[model samples]
Target: VRAEAIITRESGGGRAFHALVSSDGRRIEADLLVLSCGVRPRTRLASDAGLRTSRGILVDDRLRSWSDPRIRAIGDVAHVADPRRYAHEREVPGGPAGLVGAGWRQAEWLAGALIAGEDPSPFAEDSPGIVLLKSRHVDLVQGGEIVPDPFAPGSGEVASWADPRHGTYVAMSTTNGVLDGFVAVGMPRAAAELSLLFQRRGELPSDRSLLLRLDAAEQPVRATGRDETVCICNAVTAGGIEDAVSDGCDTVDAVGCATRAGTGCGGCRARIAEMIDEWQGQHV
Candidate 1:
């Protein structure tokens, strides 16, 4: 049987096609299609509030909407600038890394800026690379590298293992003795720490042994105090959840209804449950 996931990305529209396989190892063409993607931003509230919105509500460095100083935005609802690599001199809009960590950082920056009576600086830096928790592979790229050929020579060198066996892979690249990009799969904890290391050093490790040593650490990346959005599709965040809890919405379902967390796809349901358990443990 042949099964495939076909993805089409175009300027006008995009779609994904999934092929079905029969028990007898035969491939069957599907006439009916089912799409299981995720939620997108709903900027009507920001617009209703008189905030400037394009694809999403526009926010400044402090995540303050263009219309109201008292209102700040994070997560998918906010159209924040993305960090670009040195290779690509252009800017990508709407959040950094597109992960929980990115939202958390935005939240922290906004909070600090608000408390200090200063505007937060919009994010304008590129990550060395992002780690994909699934796929068990890493993709390494650099700025100005013409987005490597997925089928050409040296592609394997740039793209590491995607083996489902060992459940680990490392893909990284360096330019002028500095790490430019990396993508690690099935190594969320390692990926998080490596991201921090890249930011702090602004350079890759020269010694292969040291690089290996760093990778061997057992610690996973922990969220920082400044993180903004924890759930992107619904725009819910740790801080937002905390605010909801403080307002007496304590259960996960309550938080979802109150702050709109875990309403999309429910991928973050486990995390929300953990938060609820922790809150109850501490309070009750």
Candidate 2:
């Protein structure tokens, strides 16, 4: 069979010696050192529970299952539906719900729907996912739809800057003047602000080249206003953090405990820390 490899022999008992051979001439002997790889949704329980499944447990915009309205779905094992026709979102792969931020968003929305009777809204499927690589000497953050080369005169525009010595690479994409996406490698400050911009769906600065400069994001980002989100997962904001600090939440942990600004995907944690330090500097 194509793309199929079989394990011929396995023995991991008694004195604990096991040998496994793959078709690619790879052999391993172990009593289970570690087998790590990408993961998938856990849908057995949902399937046994007799809910609809399309690669995951399916649910409507309110997160209620079609077969059972009382049972709402969420997280990696759920397939959520956005009811609005314009949303252009549906059961994406690796979900009933997926991504920590989106999961938390669903949770908050669900909490409101259940507690305050708030109606659920459509999810923006094309919304960016902030990805920060957690590794030594490697800093990377990516968000939004960056393909199709936004700068090619049809979609929008693209601008980038590279610093090979400190190992920094930054590229920003804009579609019809609004920021579409960005990728920042070894440029933590740009990564942080770009993530915020992507989340807020803010327009690009008239001077697009400003995106590649380290100093440009600060003042413009400050003008994004307090209402624009700083943490979508927890609904935290620039103003919210300011108010929290004024109320004596001085540290990042304290602010997180108080307003949950830096507790989700942790992409916003750096920004939150900066906000705290900046606030303390002004007071001191």
Q: Which candidate has the highest TM-score of all? A: 2
- Give the per-residue lDDT digits (tens) of candidate 1, residues 194-253: 455555546655653344334445632222222334454444556777677768887878
TM-score of model 1 (CA atoms): 0.46
Give the top-scoring candidate (lDDT). 2
Off by over 4 Å in 1: 1-39, 67-70, 81-98, 117-165, 187-193, 207-284
Tens digits of per-residue lDDT for model 2 on 64-148?
A: 7766878987766667654343124454443543456667777766777778665656433435566555444566777765654
Q: What is the TM-score of candidate 2?
A: 0.68
Worst 10 residues of 2 by lDDT: 1-10
Off by over 4 Å in 2: 1-39, 82-97, 116-128, 134-138, 148-156, 215-235, 265-270
Candidate 2 at residue 64, lDDT? 77
